[model samples]
Target: MQMIKQKVGARVRELRNQKGLSQEKLALAADIDRTYIASVESGKRNISIVNLEKLIIALDTSFAEFFEGM
Candidate 1:
């Protein structure tokens, strides 16, 4: 679970950066808290499936594409 969290976090951060979005921007777009996004990107938060879906949507991506390399 810890490993999965870290991988997801890393992927989120990577996608966020690739999209040129800030934590605050992504949080607002995803309707999530900014601090939560920070924690998530740092691999310190185990994100819920619902919130994960929101983030993926805000990133303009799908789970299949997002987890492609993983």
Candidate 2:
């Protein structure tokens, strides 16, 4: 589970960077807290499905695309 969280976090970071979005930017777009984004990226938070969906939408990406190579 810990590894899964880290993997997801890494993937989120990759996508965010690919989209040239900062943590605060992404958080605002996703309507989540910036600290939450930081925690998620640092693998300290296991994000909920609803929040993940919000983040994906904010990234303008689909779940399949987001989870690719994971």
Candidate 3:
């Protein structure tokens, strides 16, 4: 589960970077807190499905794309 969290975090960071979005920008777009985004990116939080959906939508990605290789 920890590994999954880390992997998910890494993927989020990767996509965020690829999209040229700062954590603050992503958080703003997702309507989430910047610190929460930071924690998620750092794999320090077990993100809920609701919040994950918010992120995925903000990132302009589908769940299939987000979890493509996981």
Candidate 4:
């Protein structure tokens, strides 16, 4: 679970960076708090399915696509 969370975080950060998005911007896009995004990126937060959906939508990806190659 921990590894999965961390990998998800790492993937988010990577994708966000690739898209030239800041944590705050990504949070806004996901309709989540900036701090929450930071916490997740820092590996200090457990991601819920709702939050994951937000992120997937924010990234314009399907869950499978979002998690692909991660």
Winner on TM-score (1 vs 2): 1
TM agreement with the true structure for every prediction: 0.95, 0.94, 0.96, 0.88
Which RMSD does model 2 reach against the true structure? 0.8
lDDT of 2 by residue, 1-70 (tens): 4798898889899999999999989999999999999999999898899999999999999999988877
TM-score of 1: 0.95
Ranking, TM-score, top scorer first: 3, 1, 2, 4
- In model 1, the runs with Cα more than 4 Å from the true position are none
Which ranges of candidate 2 are over 4 A from the true structure?
none
- Output the worst ten-in-a-row residue range by lDDT, candidate 3: 1-10
For residue 64, what is the lDDT in candidate 2? 95
Cα error, residue 35 of model 1, in Å, equals 0.3
Error of 3 at 10 (Å): 0.5
Clashes of 3: 0
> Pairing residues by index, what is the TM-score of model 3?
0.96
lDDT of 3: 0.93
> Among all windows of ten consecutive residues in candidate 1, which has the lowest summed lDDT?
1-10
lDDT for predicted candidate 4 compared with the true structure: 0.85
